[model samples]
Target: MTRRTVRIAMNGVTGRMGYRQHLVRSILAIREQGGLALGGGEVLWPEPVLVGRREHALREIAERHGLTEVATDLDAVLADDSIDIYFDAQVTSAREEALKKAVAAGKHIYTEKPTATDLAGALDLARLATSAGIKHGVVQDKLFLPGLLKLKRLIDGGFFGEILSVRGEFGYWVFEGDWQEAQRPSWNYRSEDGGGIVVDMFPHWEYVLHELFGRVTTVSAHVSTHVPRRWDEQGKPYDATADDSAYGIFQLDGGAVAQINSSWSVRVNRDELVEFQVDGTHGSAVAGLRNCRVQHRSATPKPVWNPDLPVTESFRDQWQQVPDNAEFDNGFKAQWELFLRHIALDEPYHWDLLAGARGVQLAELGLRSHAEGRRLDVPELSL
Candidate 1:
């Protein structure tokens, strides 16, 4: 059995999402699981080199993760001929330039979503990657969630005869610095750092709705800065310039309208921190991160409007839980494995930089819709 190693230069391994999700949960876990089995006695080994500006932090991460290689110089990493992939999990503001460099080096590129804050930059990266003939992908982790997978299965099984509409409620209270130390970084509340609900979340909604129903034809959005002032990491108050909440209405190509509310200001009243309710002619399903509940039209109870009487029937009891018949892996890791196969075995991979640009387009149009107080058309990006 011959095994091949794909050298991966991981940039921005110090950040929260990068460290916890991609490093520990995805790549490291892939390494621990004997790398990716490429079938026929061939294994795809992920040989990762930690790349970051802070030497101490990189060294600490390498030591903790049992990694051998660490590099502080981006130029050196680009110059390294052994590296086959350049992964960018850096902040939204710092992505394009580094990715361009990776493309110049002819490295397969993989990055986080909202590939760039603007559509042009994302398209430019796509152009460079295509010209270089390098495989590229953007992280669409939400598509691989257990609940979403189950929902997709039900949709494929025709549980929903004809999809009609969707409602998504996503948020939990992000504490103001006045009470408790904010869990999220303060930069998330600053627009200068590429932080805003429109930039951050509209991309997710774009892909989710498009995948579940159809392409998003039009968007009507209302975004706001829920907390104007928030305490920083050092306990100093700073003006939060970025929008912290968004209320969006997306019209799908299949005539399904999806309304999603994302907020850090609101308290939770739903079953999960994030949930999407899809209603159709035959059934309705509510999906969270790990669980989904369904209510068929036949089982639906007829509730007469009665403001004067206490409701006796348990509304929640009518819905049946969707069973998890199969095992699930980490969402990011699942995607990582697919990307590895794409590079190693020339597997079919569709989530490319062009797809990422579409996500950026959605956010851009969403912001425009909010500002103009009108619905905006989502133009398709054709290469």
Candidate 2:
């Protein structure tokens, strides 16, 4: 068996999503599993060096993770020709410049979305990577979620004949710093730090909708700041200028409409933090993070429109739960494995920097729709 090692310089890994999801769950877990199997009695081994601005944090993370290399100097790391890949899990605003440097350094690029704060920056990064002929990708992890995977299976099996609409309900209440500690970082609520629900979540929605249904051609949205002030990590109060919630209606290429609501202020009343309900001619399915419930046209129960009488039927019980027959790995890990294979073997990778640019483009257009009080068309993004 042939064992190939791919050295990766992981930057901004001290952040929450970076530390928990990418570093620990995804990368570390992959190493623990003896890297990603590349078939033909071969495997791709990932050697990641932790990099960050905080030396203490970087060294601590490396030591705790049993990693040998930790560096605060990103320029020095990038200059090392041994590093095949450069990963950025940094805050949204800081991503483009770092990615540009990585591209210039002749390293493959992968990052968490929005890729950049706006459409132009995201597209520029894509162009930069292409010009350098480096393998570049963006995180579109939602498409790999167990629930969505099950939904995709259903769609592929013709279970949902001629899909009509998709409704996504996402988000949970984030406590204000006055009474309780904020679940997310303080930067998430400040505009100067490139914070907003639309920029953060619309990217996920863009990929999910495009992959599951079709390309989103038009969008109408309303975005607003629900909570104006929150306490910071240091227990000091700060003004939150970014929008906390976004309500949007998107029209897909095939005329399917998708309505999504994302908020940090709303409390969870559904089965999960995120859920998507798809209605079609033959059946309807609702999928959460881990589970999917389906009601076929044959199995759907008829309802009466009696307002005076008390409702007796258990409407929710009519849907049948989708069985979990297959094991599902962490979505981030799944995508990471695919990206690693794409790099190691020069395999086909669909979610490149251009797709990420599309996500950023959708978010930018969504915000523009909010500001203009009109529907905006999503122009097709090409290389």
Candidate 3:
């Protein structure tokens, strides 16, 4: 079998998600597994060129992974025609410009959402990438989660006959830097630094709802910063300008309504940090990061409203756990392989830059809906 090496310029390896998920788990894991095999008996090997502002961090990552290529300048790396793809996991504010440069350099693009800080920039990038005839995609990792995969299996199998609605709860309390160093970066709470739950999570919700259930036709949202003040990375006090929580209601094409609450302030009481409960005419299911449980209409329990009496029925036990018939890989790694295959073998990939723009559009409209205190229509987008 012929082996083709695809060098990927991976930016933002210093960040939490970039380093752990993209660099270590996905790309390096692929290398350890002898690269990705294609349909035509060709193996597509991934070689990562680490790019970031900090040379020391990049070098450290290179040494840690036993990889050689490391660069502080993106333009210099992009100048090489051998660098086939540009992958961005940078901050939202810095993504658009870097993506633009990559597109201009005639490199295929893949990035973490929302792809840009706003819808316009996202659409612009989509248009540019399309015009340049370069392949592009955005990270929609949640869709590939084991739980979501089981949920998708049920959906495709008509288990959720005539789906009615979806309820999603996501997030956990992030410690303030004063008492404890925040799990997330301080920039996540600062609006100037492209921080906000709506902008950060609504993109994820958009793709999940769109791909799993139906296209979101309308949205209504309420957003707020529950923690008005928080300590930064340096133990400095600052006003939290971004919304730490967002409650959104979306209307889907099939008349299904989805309500999702995203927050950094709320404490998680559920089984997972993020979970979605989808209800249909014939059954219902609750899906989280790694597990999915379902209750068919035939087996659903009947309960009478009696808050005055102590509840005796074991409601949680009523649902059955969905079996995992197939082994699941890391969601980020899965998407990376697909993208690599798309570039190598012209494989079909629907989650392109345009799909990413749709996610940004949903976020923008959701924010507007919150500001206006009303539901807003979502228009179809085309380039």
Instruction: State which candidate has the highest lDDT.
Output: 3
Candidate 2: where are CA atoms >4 Å away? none
For model 1, the superposed segments whose C-alpha errors exceed 4 Å read none
| TM-score per model over all chains | 0.98, 0.99, 0.99
Give the TM-score (vs. native) of candidate 1.
0.98
Candidate 2: deviation at residue 27, Å?
0.8
Window of ten residues with lowest summed lDDT in model 1: 176-185
RMSD values for the candidates in order, in angstroms, are 1.0, 0.9, 0.9
Off by over 4 Å in 3: none
Per-residue lDDT of model 1, residues 120-184, tens digit only: 99889888899899999999999999999999999999999999999999998888787797878
Clashing pairs in 2: none
Q: Write the per-residue lDDT of candidate 2 for residues 9-100, one digit (tens) a residue.
A: 99988999999999899999999998899999998889999999999998888889899898988999999989999999998888889999
Query: Candidate 2 at 167: error in angstroms?
Result: 0.5
Alpha carbon lDDT of residue 213, candidate 3?
Answer: 95
lDDT of each: 0.91, 0.93, 0.94
